[model samples]
Target chain A: MKVPCAIVGSGNIGTDLMYKLRRSPVLDLVLVAGIDPASDGLRRARGLGIEATVRGIEPILEDPASYPIVFEATSAWVHRQNAPRLEEAGARVVDLTPAKLGPLVVPPVNLDVHLGAPNVNLITCGGQATVPIVAAVARVAPVPYAEIVSTVASRSAGPGTRQNIDEFTKTTSSALAEVGGADTGKAIMILNPAEPPILMRNTVFCALGEGYDADAVAGSIVAMVDEVAAYVPGYRLKADPVFERDTYTTPGGTVPARVVVLLEVEGAGDYFPPYAGNLDIMTASAVRVGESLARELWRAAGLSERDGARDGARDGARA
Target chain B: MSASGKTGEGGRPAFRLTDSTLRDGSHAVAHRFTREQVRTVVAALDRAGVPVIEVTHGDGLGGSSFNYGFSATDEMELVREAVATATRAKIAVLMLPGIGVKEDINRVAEVGATVARIATHCTEADISEQHIKLAKSLGMEAVGFLMMAHMIEPGRLLEQARLMESYGADCVYVVDSAGAMTIDDARRRVAALRAGLSIQVGLHAHNNLSLAVANSLAALEEGADQLDGCTTGLGAGAGNCPTELLVAVCAKSGIETGIDPLRMMDAAEEAVRPIRPDQGVIDRDAIVLGYAGVYGSFLLHSKRAAERYGVDAKDILLELGRRKMVGGQEDMIIDVALELARERAG
Candidate 1:
């Protein structure tokens, strides 16, 4: 009963997603596609006994109906080119690039809203990490301005991330508004080169409108952290959300009150090292979204819950 | 200009001086540079025969944010004013790869900025490749700026410089961002870059340790083709090497910078000094910044946070240094202050 899926782009993010997809219960990874024949990610997939191709999206295009879902982990430029073709072929895309081809999705925030969309953009890793917190605060009161700073180890950022740094900032900042529910959003990323590379860390600053209860806001943030942690086990607050008044200065004006939240994300060590939580959160969130889509596809086909359970049992026996 | 200190066809040791009074000085003033201020500074520098004048937010393009202080005037407006005022000088803008996106560079270029200085931390030069290439493709002079050069050795810095050279940089700079380098430190880094990079080498020194002038001289001896200075040393932390002082020294050392030293001094005294109350002096806090090897722009932010939270700014600086915080981590100033306040209260 597992929905068959394919992954395109054999880079750090694609390779990492490959490892996560293998453990997914509702989705089966059928193919990994890349342009470079000698790419380490493609070679690693072959060694894992999974089907991998150097033809990029050609293999998936040949038999598009088989892949109900295709995860695009390539660069934003490449995703822009592949997105329309993948959609015409009738495969739902979970885009991990900064290419904002469809509605942005943060699993805990708006996954259910975009389940029926042909494609869903995960924004950038920074957006995935900080948007939920902004949504949490916004749920209590309107956020006038929200700014996030994401610091990751230099070693964890491949050449793709380095070259597309502009797109990363723009997409993440826009998501802070479009997904995180802020009037204005600013994003900054830092590549830390400290020896013994540091875990991915984020600082989210939100400027709130008038008459919001601080206690209610703090409670909302705490609850949201728990929900995100349910999928991303290593996602946790480095410090409690620090509330202050009249500290943040936005383009509109100086805000009356603000809250600061610090977060550290440690990877699941699926493919990259533990410090590469930037990549981990994207793949983890993708898996969460892909599973939801698979469940919906099953329901659309009039499949019963018992069928899923029986299929799981059979797969377990085989293992 | 040659790395061997050879005299050019003009019959004197060739050297270039870039004035950064409008850009780095924004940090000392908390990033509140008015358009009039920018125009005045640019006019003064241009009149004094400065070949390059850099103008941007203190942290670079797109730096006006909640973390970094906001500019009083939009940076593009200020750049326009500088461009309109300067006749002899080519205008430059600083763009940190992560903080400032390509759109910011495009905007600056559209506003007539001819030079783009793409900056990164000393060890993170890989991030500057795209921006450097973009600048070059835009037909602008691209310079790779490596900040916090004192944190890494000369050999490692040269490796980073090599990365920038491979990215098509017109020149590479050994920037003592913390102002912690001594004469030897400056000499060795400039020498390494000059020896390793086929492109030109530049030096950007600060006066935190009161060695800005001496270090600039050492860099000159190592054949640094370009050097940055500010009018009256009006820049971040203890300010930068004073443009007037650097020109005077270069003249005394038999170097031809094509700048009028007396006009530069007059600009500092009449145009620059009156706008700011204090000269960029080597104060205790600034010295602590150098001693701790913290980013120079953190000075005012740390001081304000420490004062607001009722903690020691020096202690905050030392902790930031211990954590190896680089530039663009200005938000951590308030975080460190809050942590210290909680510790004291508990």
Candidate 2:
């Protein structure tokens, strides 16, 4: 028996998930609903012989029996309005909006809880990157305050992100609340207006409570970052550098971050590098976390159960 | 009646604090600040007891005329507008001679400025004569701004300071435009400015070294009479001594800065809102650019070059920096070539 799944909003993520879904033996690639028929993702899905339609997105969410599971990958505002309707109809919703309507999920960390939910909110690319660091930091320190500076090439953030920029604070906090606890959290987001946008990058500054050695804290941060990065493919620390004060330049001409590590020790410069590296590591982790949540939900939607029967066919491509 | 106290000669704080944001920060965003923002900033500075503000760009028209420096607004309008708004703060305007010498001095006075600064690169200052003399003739308080104080020899800077003083300038500013100078370097430059000239000495610090406060404090300790700052350290690359840091440090050290150092928080929040990048900010790149002895604006160029070349932005920056590329110098290879020519001549 095929576990039927519908792909909603055939954008980049929706299409990629569609391709992955078609390859699964247990899941029926039932219908692809796109707001824009001309979107390249829908075109590609149509070419692959997957059922595709546009504009009347309601058809997929009209009844749960039509498609047992729905992947909501539209703009933030769109997802905020669409996710509830899909969930109410009894189809479990996997939302890809950066909006915080329900819970934000970074799979490997929050998989146990969200996998059982009727509706799950996936963190934004930035949230996916930083949530793990929040988890890692909470493991070692009594965090009183945390601040994140997330800079991305303007191009990397979509229109949904821009519209929900302010809510990024609430959305990120909700994700962090699930795993990494902080007394107070602050995020400063920047979008570079560069004509040809650069890759997404972020920097985090965290202040742990009393009796904490910021340097040791920074070390713990690096280890935890390494843990999360391991889960995040294509994300690696660009530099393992000893940053000097205010000179964030590395030996390889990479900008060595300027930092003044504040410890109870007063004017200490020791904790800056590991702290800097951890920020980068955590930020990349956030992107992977978002993707991981999407994959996990689809698997639990019973595709894996069906994949088992056709194991011989998928075994060759399992890797 | 003094805003802070009795205005009996030398009673309120010797020199007023001036935020050179629109002027120096213009180096970062190409002086994109609107007239309305400028007016608000001047009002905020006025409320803070900042008595002098430099409205710049030599008729606001300098930058690379046929090339790529910050082309300022019309000198008269830029100065007059600020002067009209901040009646208490002396309206001061800056002009880079030869860049705007012919059109500036008389127009600066016409625009209602009370003080005019004549700017020149110490590496090439002989050509600034006509502009400096014109400011003096107009009876405006004349100032000579010598940029990139590190790139030029100390002795040469002293000579230039002496020349500006002799040419009837009221003050000489040692601008560590790169924010690269150490406290020691700042002290030496300030001392040199003071020792060689009868006019007051000033320091315009950048945060490239993250030492704007340290350097400015050193200059003051060494007897420099004037200092420059900004709202939220929001100028070019890394920004300058945060106006708050300067005031706070000065207050903590017993120097009389009539402005409330705390008001800086208000200023910082106001000025940095529009300019901050999305996502990661005031982070590693800022710290690195500070250490490299340059402004943050250059990073935009490096980032551009990196994206275009599909290589590392940091590599692009180092290559540009090895040649001493100034932040506002977009066609900077030419400036590097000029430096080469000067080195050969020397």
Candidate 3:
């Protein structure tokens, strides 16, 4: 059985998510809605035989049974207002905005923990790329603080992202602590304007507890990269983990024994250019979450293990 | 005598002054500006009536790392001390969006930094909107800086400046980070920005071609509303436009900077010059780097790479220029130098 999903906000991110769902096994994309009927995204979705609307969430509310899951891809401000209404309609929400009214989820790190949540916030793209690594380090040794700097091509950021800059930083930073298990977290984003746009590059600085073994931390981080790569095929480490012994004395105070990891995420060319690893990670991770949630609903609806295996065999045979 | 006093070439536009001695000068000291040095220099600049003083790693905020030379003292500590020392001047920081984040800006603001100059490449002003908006929301005076302004033409520069203005930059700067722009280049870009943008226009010049002061004058003639200078011309790659020289020139030309030239000279000669590794002068290396349109910040990295690989720094810089490498690609310096050394050996 396929769980029905609808995408609101037919912009770059929402449209991209629609394209990705075309290949999903369990989630059926039924509607692509936006504020602009003339938007290219809505036009494209209509051409693809998906129900496209400009009326926004009211239609989804009128026919809530058609969409069991709604992907909220609007700006953070819009999401803050729409989230409660969607919950009242009894539809699970996958928020792409930084409004973050729901529990934050990074597929590789904590998707299962928040699978039952009514709304799951994907956090920022930077959070998706770096949080798992932070979690891996936290598992090995105590991480007092973690900081990540995400650099992406300027051309990739849309106006909505440009407007919600504060929410982006605040949500990404808080998720590092709340989801990655870091004591404290800070996030920075850079938009590179090079002629040939650069790939998404991230620098993660984790302040490890004194006496933590460098090898163990590196080992755990490398393993975590592999797991994230299972969903985000473009995820990889730019270089081996570098250990630095230094005292960083800020006006706030001093931080000691820092371990730095440099990461680069090359996009899979799903709906954006290969350099748009920031967008790719979000869509890819959302698919993983959506599939898992669809499976859970199927099980809760009395679909047995044999039935799941039968569905898988039928899909395999059809392919 | 008002802090907001405006005086320019024809007594029309009132220009503001920002001092970069402690910030950009950190490059000359190998990023090792002591807390005491920051305290003393900021105090002197403040007394000299400079309106704004930028404080951060020479490359910008969050630049203290192994790749970029580590700062001798923490930048936030330097920021706090600079803030405490200044009485009239508003403390500012140079933040390249990728290098520093909102948290860093908030931390500096908490310590009393009231201004943020968000910088981007000339064509990439759109990237600065988020950061600039954040700065304005935090109640800081936000400025947009377009680095390597010589790389593009006036019409395009105006478009980028307009984008920044829409994003809430109080002012926009055409940065000759390589000190490569001639007087005409400065005039054309500043004129375009003045004509097209409703917001204020500014200029940041280097002295690699010994044209920092002259280029700055030309920009002011084109109605540039703000200018940057470093004490004793202390900054990256032949340093910045000398603050004392700019003040003296403005005075003689009947333009007002609201700063006393004599007092600025005392600060430059007594407080700044003593600690300088070298005065800002157009040496052969700086000339070549500027001639090739390479970034001013790349000089130290190229020099270090040349030393490590036993290659000529001049050849490395020229090759980097030919490759059209921009800032943040410092890793390529050593790679290019190594190739040059291999070719020489062959």
Candidate 4:
């Protein structure tokens, strides 16, 4: 028996997931939900030969009377609004927002725990990307301090990200503490709306308090990131900058800045390579986590729709 | 009487003034100062007790649109020639934030160069700190320069100042290389640089809007002892506060400038004389840049926009600097210029 699933948003991320799921074997697509009448989700559903329904939050929450699972792709606040309704109706929900309605998940760190939970929430994007690196750091160097700077395209960033700037810090810290095993990671995130958009979440300056196996630590971090990215998708590593320079004018004169370097290592060593690898691993892990949620939502809904038609055909033959 | 009620150079002071002609001033001319002319000016600044002669590389580490021409010069020869009768006065060189390593820095410091100024722009303080630390580590008399001081407040500038000072900066300079500051602002900036840092404060003025002399003098009066000058005011955007004027102002007032003022004027004429006609003279665009306190980088920017979007350079420069430019619109200016080029190309 297939579990009826509902995809509650048809935005960029949602649409991409739908195509991926319809082609996959594990899950069925049942209901495609949306908030706007003008969403491409409705048109896409029709193109996929899936049922087209008008958009509303109430309809999606009510869907579990038939569709018994929900994938919430709304903002954190909206997830909070829809969480209890979906859970009480006996539908397990997976949320894409930073809001933690239930257990937070990343496949490498908590895959089994997430599968076991009736409702699961993926923490902030930074949590998904940097947790593995943090775990790696603890294994080899054991840190007293860590910070990640996840600069994003401002337009692509979710709502409440800018208006509530403090929330970005709070959410990042809370998520890092939960995953890193020490409630002490800081996040300084920026939304650079620069042209020719750069998509990189760079983590810098992880000071590891001495005593541990740094090579083993880096390996573990890389493994976790690779594992998560394999299961999910869309996470990739970018460049590492060391000895960065620019021109600065001071009261004295215009002096050229010839060397500025920040290094992250799991041990007492000071260099740029360790932190560069750490940042790449962590970011890749987080992006994959998001990818996995999309896959699950699309599969469950599509399979459940198929199951419904099959049941109807069998009933007619028996009659 | 000057606008400040006195020639703001109103000071009795004793210090060798160094005009960064053909060096820091290279940015005004697109870093292609003719070889003969560069040699003439560098030699002249040395002849005058302007003492330290600084040469090219306005933006270090591939930071600028082009590299400085000094790469072609035999650096050792250039250094020796610029400081013929080496007194305590030295040949100074500058670098941008990310271009060279500690080994490279030590090499420059060893090759007859006494001071190496490493710089970072205002928004890049967090990015600039580590480089300055490296320069200090190399045992170079490292001076950290923060550009576009007008865009940032005194307090925020102080935080960076203190850090550079902590990293062993012998001097931290406030650079109005943009020429966008008033005399009062210069004083406040000088105070800010000295407030939290133990290092001495230096002032490098750009002669945009004819305010360089006033601002530099104001900075000196407000406790800045280290200052930058250029012979014949040959520098970026209008140029620098004149070495001759500073020395004369210092000398006529019975101030103790070790520099010989008359010697500096003679050097200026010698350096100002015609070189190969193929190498252009003081530019018209740089003059306009000084009058408006705008960067003389408009031409380079246009050239870039042209390459990026395949449009003509002249149009991009004109539209980008039009009224839409702001107090700190460096990033926006480039973006708009590129956009204009794209639009025209289409």
Best prediction by DockQ: 1
The Cα error of candidate 4 at residue A308, in Å, is 24
Clashes of 3: 2
Tens-place lDDT per residue, model 3, B1-346, is 2232335445443589999988888888878999999999998988888989999998788777544566888899999999889999999999876556667888888999998999877877776887898899999999999998998999999998999999999999999988889889988998899888888899999999899999888887788889999999999888899999999988887788888789898899888999974687677889987798888888887887788678989998898787666665565565577578768899
The predicted structure with the larger DockQ, 1 or 3, is 1
Worst 10 residues of 4 chain B by lDDT: B61-70
RMSD of 3: 4.7
What DockQ, on C-alphas, does every prediction get?
Answer: 0.61, 0.01, 0.19, 0.03
User: What lDDT score goes with residue B323 in model 3?
Assistant: 63
Which runs of model 2 end up more than 4 angstroms from their true locations? A1-319, B1-11, B57-60, B64-66, B69-77, B271-290, B295-297, B325-328, B333-346
CA lDDT scores, all candidates in order? 0.89, 0.58, 0.83, 0.55
> Can you list the residue pairs that collide in candidate 1?
none
Ranking by lDDT: 1, 3, 2, 4
Q: For every model shown, what is its TM-score relative to the native structure?
A: 0.94, 0.46, 0.84, 0.49
Residue A113, model 3: lDDT of 89
Error of 1 at A15 (Å): 2.2
Tell me how candidate 4 scores on lDDT: 0.55
Per-residue C-alpha lDDT of model 2 across residues A93-205, encoded as one tens digit per residue: 66765555666676546656766577666666556666656665666766554444444544444455543454664556445555556555544444433333334444443
Best by TM-score: 1
Candidate 1: where is the Cα deviation over 4 Å?
A: A35-49, A247-249, A304-310, A313-317, B1-13
| Candidate 3 to truth, TM | 0.84
